[model samples]
Target: MAFKFFDKLSQDFAELLNDKKEYNVVIEVDKEENMKSFTTHSVVLRYRLPYFDKELENATTNENHIKTIIKPNISAQIFEIILKYIYGGIVNIEDTDTKTIYELMVNADELELKELSVKLENYLIQSKASWLKTHFSFVYHSIFDSDKFKDLKKFYNDIIVKYPNLIFESEDFTSLQETALISILERDDLNVEEIKIWDYVIKWGIAQNPTLPADSKEWTKGNFKALKITLQQCLPLIRYFHIPGEVIWKKMKPYKKIFEEQLWDDMTQYFISPNEPITSLILPARIISNPELPSRVNEPFSTIIKNEHVAELSSWIDRKSTTYSLSNIPYEFKLILRGSRDGFHPKTFWNMCNGHVGTIVVAKVAGNDEIVGGYNPLSWDNSTSTSTRMCAKDSFIFSLKNGNIKNSILSRVKENDNALRYFDSNEQNVYGPLFGNCEFMMRSNVSDFTQDKQCQCKYMESPIFQIFYNYEKPIRKTIELFSIVDYEVFKVI
Candidate 1:
């Protein structure tokens, strides 16, 4: 067996990156205002990066025989990391922030550094998953623009498949790229109703052409043709044969001009006669999964609360004097966001529970059996720039009865105008669900609720704080802030 000195060789190559004496390539990166230039070796760049090889070929040399390449779109910080990886085969991202690392991965992919880009992509998915989910829209849209990150696409699509509403109901759903929408529609387990999917597709197509008439009945032939062309890529992906005949007649009949004459005829015939053969291709029905709930098999519905707690909470929601029975609870608590499963970051709460309405947020107090929570009948909005108070007469905060708690306390909103507080986009990183006058609020200065004792439940019984009592009573006996063991946000369906 032969011994190798690759370690020494790598170190030497890394040192060469700092030597400006013999470098023949001058690379300029970032925009004109903050532009930076780096010196590199042509031989190393040619072998390490395929993109650089072609770029170098077309580049003309100066009198000093140094080739210059400019990349204004790439930030100087990201290119510096890439340059180091190219020369030394080392990427020291230990101190780099997640956003910077993501930018590095994108730049590496653009530079055709497959190994570096793939490594960064996997690292982001495995280690920085919470951040990815927190910035879901940006990450999802950016990845679909290029086909290089297949793993990231799959990682996000897995989440989208289970919770189709995350993407389908988002504010930017209309702005979604055609390729991205097609990829989602092509999934066999999309977990949305066929008619709903049809509606969303039509909605997306209409959004693309704002000039189209608002009423489908008022559409001219040209308007229909314009819509048909806009949805050409997405139309075929829909499983026409699986949609109910009534739904098809109600929804699909309006857009009949979009479909090919033969395919539409075949669909009509297939609906009339189930056994009749048709020339058009028939896609299998999408596997509609169970309603949105915790997918963990053999796991309890919640770690903090149980069925009894759910019944009590249900009673509170319905304004009933007595708790409902376990078998006859009026609503189902569909798990939307769990701190343990999703993340403890305040931003994670805003990201996952943005548009959800009628949500129950329960948090397990650290080192105690006290389960403090609040019910918000209004939807959580993360799109606003300023903090907004939601008006709700039914919203309330409560302390559920558990091991040490002998009696449960429920406090309904005293001030309907200030029932709940929705933090602005900037403040979302520090604050989560806030109920009346900081009565029941989750806050984390370190961006994690579990790591800090900033979560507060102010005692409203004190005379000095009487004016700030937005709820009927304080959920906690003490006014001091505390940390939480875990938290969960469930949509009351």
Candidate 2:
């Protein structure tokens, strides 16, 4: 019974829209010959669409109380569709192409029809998700042109992250607007390495000037000068510290003239002095590398990074998965605390380490400038006995700063029953199941620290397979990864 009433109401409104000639106003959508005019009643326009009502009030009128208005940018075809929605509240875009729909959406926003614009935006996202993907660059440029399309901007970027090739390798990549290109570089999940991204950043900078040669090989000092102007805002966004020392001295050395002297000095120190605390302004590792958040992340601990990087990490921790659709955890790290600042005594870390289990402890080798750390799956209470056994069974130590992991000792694990454990930690940073006293673990344990009897007195526990540590470079190139802990204490919510 209720359906009948709505049906009749719809029919009446449809008929009213069709009988537009009887109205006292005419809205001409375009000035071109054979242009279209919309017949609409001022009363309906005033009550439903404020833009039209205002247009009518300001509209030039004739003696017979009739008024005509012109809409300069909108085409008659789009107005025909918009008028129907205005009078009848029905939008039948059947068989409409994504381009026309995008045009219609743009017109809708200009007309100040907030609800209509939103409905069109949602339909474009859901119904034409794939089409949007294909036309991502065009769609993004359209959104970038106007700040009013905030939803479209986010929607476009969400898709960009899933298929980065759309931006990185697509023909449109070099031609993208400067802001759009910067947006791509800022994302952590870009699926490209920093070196590759740096190369691309150069390509984009070189593409800006048609007067300059397209090939960078032909570029002169003047070309670099021009590109420096274009990439001034983009230069700082790159994570220079993440790039290897050799690459910086070789590949980036060519571009060093553009960098500030202090910044260059900072990079020089960062690459040369491994143990020295970094004071330069460098961003911590990005928090979310995947679309979904991971189930677990290292609780905040000190490394080389400072407190400024925690806001993003904390936000990720608060929102990441507990058990739902899990995410792939990236091997990125952030600096949290340094014994140089926070004190080396184990009790100094008691408040940060006491309650948290699953804490990842990373320490820089004092003399060799190597990075060594372990993952603890159990809590670190002050009362723990030196004889504490490997009950958690998931704890393990690894070498990342340098050196080959001698055996299958430090394989990344999702979960395991036979994990390494540690005990006999003192007030200093020493605590691992691989040994009961102050000592190094694995093959290098016998190298120097062991030869010097670094541990009070005890043979370091042996792993199922030997692990190794080397400072200059890892025995296996793949092992050359280390993250400065950004925040020492964080938990996935």
Candidate 3:
């Protein structure tokens, strides 16, 4: 038979026991199972052990711990209701407010039956059945007023220490809203990481918020401050999988400048390292060269004219001749003059110049273009294909700052005939094609920083070289090729 049948029978029996006019009966406290199993109509009275010590004593029997009989002239309906609650953790439709359930669990906890209390609390939270949300709010108010639940606090600590295993088996959400709600209620102390986890959940809806408001008499902004500090601390710990550092910044950007500033330091630790790949790093705008200043880059066939008097040439060559624009005014210029035409124009005049007296020229910038023409003043030492041409413009001199990579770079250029050179220019050579087109594509100016709220696109234009040498004047030049890092001149190869 159904347990409900025994429950009704128990209620009827209790009513009979309570009536003074009816015959009195003695009951065995341990005979409860007989009532439930015997007759479908038998009245079986069941009462869950209450918080009082007397209730436990009253419910217990000498022979068996689980079996018990109750002698009460209780109302049949009330007895039935209570009996249902004891067995099923719920009762059939009746007017019972959420406050009653909350109180019952509280009493259960007080009675040292923590398992039942915690289980019921968890069920309520999961069911979204907390009509007692207001009651929890009141509890928050009271807890906010004083530090109570000292024993429960100790239990909470132990529970957290074993959280991984305990939580895995439990039905609670990873980030429980009640946790924050409870902390707000009980003046509970939570560390930085815990608070952060709570804040993330609450903001993201994985957890619920506490009932207290910022302006309530019981409310204080201390929790908000704690939440902020928690988020700030978590920013660095989140980089284990190499997420883009900028994403973290975007999430935390609304904070005051001081907070935003600190986040940079935290993110920098993960974004920069000698061994780290360039693609993984996110550097501030300051480290890059200004796209507006094209001179920062070095390229093959580019020339730097330290002497301001040397005529600088424009990037384009006249279609009719082998000579590049001007060959005398000193300034950086592209050594390989490339355009639609690429054959020997016998009509073009070549003014041979000696190296030591003509001007110091460098070649092999990291780009593609022809290395010889009428503008290539340095004469070849051997047959056309066998000789290395001296670049009037594309190149860079050796320096410690730009990786001192000139010599090795020059050697590679001579051997490959197709390598672009890169180096830093500190202004000694004015005739060099100041920088390359590719290098100009990756940077911006510092003045634009405040104007940009987010990282912006680099819409820099391509490089246009203007010759700084005077081509009209006849000159003698000796052709010599130097490596990008090893500044040695290349012999005929």
User: Between prediction 2 and prediction 3, which has the larger TM-score?
Assistant: 2
Highest lDDT: which candidate? 1
Q: Could you tell which candidate, 1 or 3, scores higher by TM-score? A: 1
Best by TM-score: 1
**Candidate 1 lDDT score at position 14:** 91
- lDDT score at residue 296, model 3, on the 0-100 scale: 14
Q: Name the weakest run of 10 consecutive residues (lDDT summed) in model 3.
A: 484-493
The candidates, ranked best first by TM-score, are 1, 2, 3
lDDT tens per residue, model 3, 175-281:
43344433422222222233243334335231233443643234345644544454443333322223344544544343323234444454456556535443333
TM-score of each: 0.54, 0.51, 0.24
User: Whole-model lDDT, candidate 1?
Assistant: 0.85
In the range 1-493, model 2's lDDT, one tens digit per residue, is 3445766776687789778467888888776875788777888888778887678879999897789998867888888888888877888775466688989998998888889899999877654553465466677776776778777777766555654644565445677788877777787666656776788887777677668776666778887788889889888888888889998888888777667788899999988896787667886554335454222334433343223223223223223223112122221233333455664433445545555444555444443434444455456555556534343334444344234323312322222323333334452244322321122232123222222223221121343223322111122223222222211332211
- Candidate with the larger lDDT of 1 and 2: 1
* Candidate 2: 10-residue stretch with minimal lDDT: 468-477
